[model samples]
Target: MPLRLGAFVHRRIIAPGALASATLLLAIPASAASYSPGAPGIGDPYYPAYGNGGYDVSHYDLRLKYQPATDELEGTATLLARTTQDLSRFNLDFVLDVGEVRVNGAEAAFRASGEHELEITPRTPLPKGTAVTVVVRYRAVPSTKQAYGFTGWHRTPDGGIGANEPEAAWWWFPSNDHPLDKATYDVSVAVPDGTQAISNGTLQSTVSRLGWTRYNWRSNKPQATYLATLAVGKFDITTGRTDSGVPVINAYSKDLGDNYGAARASVERTGEIADWLSGYFGKYPYNALGGYVPNTTTGYALETQTRPFYSPRQFANGSNVSVVVHELAHQWYGDLVSVAGWKDIWINEGFARYAQWLWSEHEGEGTAQELADHVYASHPADDAFWTVKPGDPGPDNQFHLAVYDRGALALQALRNEVGDDAFFALLKGWPRKYAYGNASVAAFRAYAEEVSGRPLAAFFDTWLFQPSKPGVSAARGASISTRDPGTKGAPGRPESWKKIAATNGVHEHPER
Candidate 1:
């Protein structure tokens, strides 16, 4: 028997009102051939209803058109997926009003149901392991909604930026909006001839006809839904390769004016930083390297797959080099080796924080150990930083200081336990082993213990699980020697950086 048929038979299939004769009822099995509705959610505790079940989406081909004058966005999404079980109906997370939906080239019945779910019922039942194609046409004015933070597609002063992280990908396109379900993307955007549109991966081509120009971009690597992005605006584009010969392209908003030169300089530094990151954390993971779309409306920066998005107000400051380091490092930790659930966000944030410290050390500012010890001593025992654990910081406080600060502190503690050589090996090995996949905190602990050839259950528990700050020896362990923070020079903006800040009218300061 088919796997789905057996499971469906156990559940209710017939109504009680149906009354049949004994002979007629006995003629057929109580559980006959019938397909069941796909599960509404993927069972995530924090975000239970965001990602749907019963189908594994492999690829998304999105064609979009934006009218800045009207703030309207129209999109056609083609999803290629495989049925994990016999599916009569499945859900695709969506927020925009849809015009039409099709299954395998035939019209399919669909309704906008629940919060951000587009439930679709195919004309015929799709058997388990069947390949399927779903196409949806939708149009809506791009708008931003507040979730963990302000995200979704936002209309800037003259253009727009898609900053969908967590569960906001459904705002612009229909998808299995979860990190665990990774898929490649082919995005094409049509905007006014004067504007530029950008997305992830390599730029395939650009064609202009009449008054509109269409931009084609492709991401061959598997990408989480949240990491996907699309930015349309009036941009100054620079196409070239990085210092290490990696194909690089950067798009900066023309709205910057005199500040545009500074933004371009910061973007040009991407290749150099890519080379520096490769030296410490193995080779560059992606094929192309460069995306620094400066949007003023966005208040923060995000590691959106191949290209990361930044805000001119926050990221263009002289301090952007460190900020750039943080987001770029995520290319390896968050983008390449993703977190399976929202709870494992530390693996992404903590690693990126540690990378900042490593970059500081490389620049002769301070060592990771020194920075770790200083941060540990600076925070009071009663501070909320220690109270909220990184593993589960609740939904609203997910990006709190604990995840970024204490999370890095935990890695530093582990480095103290395993020594420099073993710790670095683990850093390079972890991402390489689980490249383009997801891993949990428990998996990280087990992998760390395996690589170090020692037991660290107590060490992880004291820092990560406990609500209070651990003692110095507990954080550093007995094997590692304590380095005096005073021995290192006081942190200060370098003279060259100060000159850049003066010229750019921006300030350069280190992050907490």
Candidate 2:
């Protein structure tokens, strides 16, 4: 359950008077006749100003140092990229105190333009397809900065955690912040001698100096910028290997008093759960498998790459393995195969929610068909939940409950329409075809049609895009049985659905 904050409005500073436009136009260099400034945004309809254009990043090497006591972060980021077009200048999503910027070893001019855009102009125009290196030196107190009424930095008593949905890298590191552009990462951080710093992928090395310890982590596979995360604090770390030989690492904050046992009870099963999910999602996609529970007041969990981030509040009521199933499923759906755009979010959340239902059936709590029937029968014909189109949920309702529950219902409906053999093949084949890349809902629909050998346009339109509850005829056409077969009575919900619903309460984001 990732936090769905308010929409981010890209703000700009406007100079006063009618001469403002002309003054800005004159600032361009007259010598640049053939080259032009790169677009500031990556051109996403939902969030236009997210990532930059003109360059495709291949790798990011970050060397950082942090002092939790002072809440200051200093870093040098070097990016290896290739130009997509002839460029005079480009932008990186960042908000920090920049001391210097260099492109291919020469000093480059830089300035802050929009709320999060750092404009950089190279000493020489870069030709299309030219290999380039960019280095930026910057420092900032992340918790003090806010863009568009939100800050993704989480401050704790002992240290800080850099993990959030939609956006977080702008607070700690400059990047091409969008899922459309993914690259491998090398993250190296230095903290106090006794403190620990954790990030994505495998731990490469650790070197201790006079009073600081530096830990280096590397991700070999392509990763979305938002999927990158960092946590710094005192922790109890446990390491092991899964049954399939994938590495497993779990960390918990040392101060998580009453929630420690329950958190461990649930997260300790990461290996077993991942092994089970592989039966349906093919081989586990990543070399690392694990999770971490940081002591934060935020009430949601994020599928942060290899190591998902869990809030202490998730375990407030004892062990909750259901949430673990939801997040781990994301390793394949959300992390490995990300949404091409924000509107295709149902591909990430719906598949993960369906995994939970599969886990419930595996545990014998309820069958998948039974759960779908109960959910369909519980919602009335006039309920507003049916109004949300999971395939294209608007930005404001991106993480609405319908996107999870109703989205899963849509999958169950598809399973009934396509039969188990083709449905299971689609589940296992979708990730394999699009591993380490971005995909859209339209692509998935076409893939489903190919696998099932049936036209799914009308079925998909009824389940995903329609604004009202589907008719009884449509439900029967999908083979959904709304009533228990054992009872000779009107439509009735299953008792197991009540138990499952009670365990998963409607989680909400805390005020930042």
Candidate 3:
């Protein structure tokens, strides 16, 4: 029995108590759309919550004709999805940062209790092995800045960083925000004449109509909704391959973040980093890899599945090359081996930073002093560092030292205590062992010890969990191959890691 609630798109017929807050751009997904196991909860077992059972959204074949006239998103989005668990419900988020929305054939409710949500619930129950179709029709002005109107300097005459995207992807459309819930996607972005539109994965087709442009993209692997992105601007396109021979296409917009040279570096070096990772670790975790560097205001990069979003300014003129390495590392560490919650951010940031270290050492420090200095400076050394344990990288430490410096140091110490062969062997196996899913910090630590054939408890306890950097004990029969200690254990001179250190926020040398 389906209860009919004749609520307008902006207002709900259901009691305000029963209907979640209908925020502008966000709302319900999965559980309410189809038959659900029961009423959904606040968080799911794997992904961010619309509070329901498995909302299997693995494959998408978006079929639509779109036009961006009058600055509105006018089109149809046909979605096909399956669930991991049974008993009926499915849900997802869509930016709907536009004017209107609808689902299937009915007037699906746009129930966003907060920002960036649209809920669609069907009247009947469907059994397992059943797939559902969702079609949305809508229009609105795409925000020039990031989603939700993040303020910035006014646009330059040419519309540079002055008009930047303040926030990340979830602003565009909705799906599960976290990576544990994967969705294979087919996206078609249509823009104005002479403008280019890009999304994740391969470009299947691009057609220009009377007055608008359309580009369709499809992703074969499962992906989180947050990483799903769309870019519409005047862009320069380049197609290339990674070092190990995986093909990729990169899009750079004129005066966007970076220009031709930066795009070239990303196309060239990001693949090389992938090869380095595969050589030390194992196969590239993803089936495909590429990126979209929109004309954006973000200072850092978002490692969105196979395709990451980079700010052109970082790579232009060869400035932030290691960022390419760090973000590419996230393809495996963040996108593929996702952390279960925001708390476990280190699993994403730490490993990526470690990749930068590996690249630094491989390239040669040009001198012993240079290499030693590079590693020491990267340690999160203040008493504050002690407070920001590996598990809890303090409020200030989350994206900063604990995750970046402490995380990198953790790997360096492990490599020192164990050997490079054993250390890298563990990293290579990590993604293969826990591909496209979540794992706790404890699980990772144990895996390292098991693979190394040594007890890493001291290394882990003293660094990963301990509040302070406990004094290093004697080797205790463990073979220690550290770079070098100088001036009574004080951190010595810095050099070699100019590329890596640059990305970590240090622009100067470490005091000896």
Candidate 4:
């Protein structure tokens, strides 16, 4: 997910027949066998209907074909999963038209329900703990589909892109669309001969036929659905490796004009930045490290697993490695260790923002302490920036500036409270402990306390939970100072801080 500032109004469009079908599926007979219908939701407090229940997916094998001229996407998705309970029916988060569905080779009955659910009742109930293989064939014009008043599928002039935060997989593939259910992927996309398709992890091979070419990509590590991305377009691709031998593959759309040079300059540093980030945050989480810049009006960038997605706007003001640092930091916090719920976004955005501050210090721009002091002095006590609590910012305020900057401020405060050794140790140990899994804010707080050998309940409450500005007391830490409202105090910001703010500041509009 990218950093932007604004509230979003979510609207859902439900088909007329959807309600009746959903009602029928919910009516499970008590006298029947042990089998039951899987719950429609995975029970995230922020977005209850985001993910499905009853089965845990291990891998997704997607064979897809897209015709750029028609914007039509046809695919066969095979999911390898294990039943968590005896399930008579299970649901997958999807919006496109599903033509055929099979469970263990038997045809299953399925129908569209609500906005983005495919309700399927297999011929035989899936026994608990049994491994199951599900195959679905579907087709749709991804650009024409909308769920929750937004479309994750972006139609490029040459082809299309499947990329978004919290919700993107539904637009292109049937998935258990949430971070809690991480799975490996084998994405095979077929496009016109001249165009190219790119995805996560390693590119296994490319085979061309008469007029179409297929690109096969494999992600061996478990990944959240939203982190899986697909881009089909004409691009200038570059390949290299970090000093540690992590393969780096960067791509830029050929259609970009003047921004192409800056985009290339910033994104091509992916290898160097990843290697630099490895020093503070431990080793880079993925085997392949790189980024891509598509010719998109989307104003923000996203940490899409191995290959982060960059919007051209990020480089409009010349090379902006801060955004790259932000997204790459997420490869550790957001991609490697995901949020248990969306409200725990601070663990992702805040840590990533802090990485930008660290990068600034590394580049001789500003120290992390100086940046923290500058941000604290820049905002007054009465500013609404303090009102958005980073710990549990509501869904609309999830991407607010307060979440990113204040979240980083919270980390800086912790560094001031805890010794340098403990602070850095926690940062490096966190990803290793929860690597390739999901964790919550409370868990992180507990881990912080355990690692620092200090109870930080009050400190976290003041910095992350309270709506008002934190008091400048000795107990609250030494990073922030008390100042009269709207007064510039000691420790003035460095000159480079202005450039960083201009390039990475939270915008007035929401990012996709």
Best by lDDT: 4
Off by over 4 Å in 1: 1-34, 144-151, 257-259, 476-512
In order of appearance, the predictions have TM-scores of 0.88, 0.91, 0.75, 0.92
| TM match of model 4 to true structure | 0.92
> Candidate 2 vs candidate 4: which has greater TM-score?
4
Per residue, candidate 2 scores C-alpha lDDT tens digits across 1-512 of 11111122245565577477857666876435457677788877888898888888889999999998987999999999887777889899998889999999999999998889999999998877789999999999988888887788888888888887788899999988888889999999999999899899999999999999999999889999988999998889999998999999899999999999999998999999999999999999988878888888877888889999899988887888888888899999989899899999999888888898998898887778877777677777788988898999887778877788888889999999999999999999999999999898999999999999999999999988897877889999997765534456534554445534533432334443
Residue clash pairs of candidate 1? none
lDDT of 4 by residue, 422-496 (tens): 999999999999999999899999999999999999889999999988877832355565554356556676656
RMSD of each: 5.5, 7.3, 9.6, 8.3
Which structure is stronger by lDDT: 2 or 3? 2
Instruction: Give the range of the ten consecutive residues with the poorest summed lDDT in model 1.
Output: 503-512
Tens-place lDDT digits, model 3, residues 274-341: 88877765788665677666665455566766777676556655756677778788888877777655
Poorest stretch of ten by lDDT in candidate 4: 1-10
lDDT of 3: 0.57
Better of 1 and 4 by lDDT: 4
Question: Which stretches of candidate 3 lie above 4 Å from their native place?
Answer: 1-54, 61-71, 82-91, 95-107, 125-130, 142-169, 256-263, 316-318, 366-382, 394-397, 474-493, 505-512
Candidate with the greatest TM-score versus the true structure? 4
- Tell how far residue 137 is off in model 1, in angstroms: 0.7
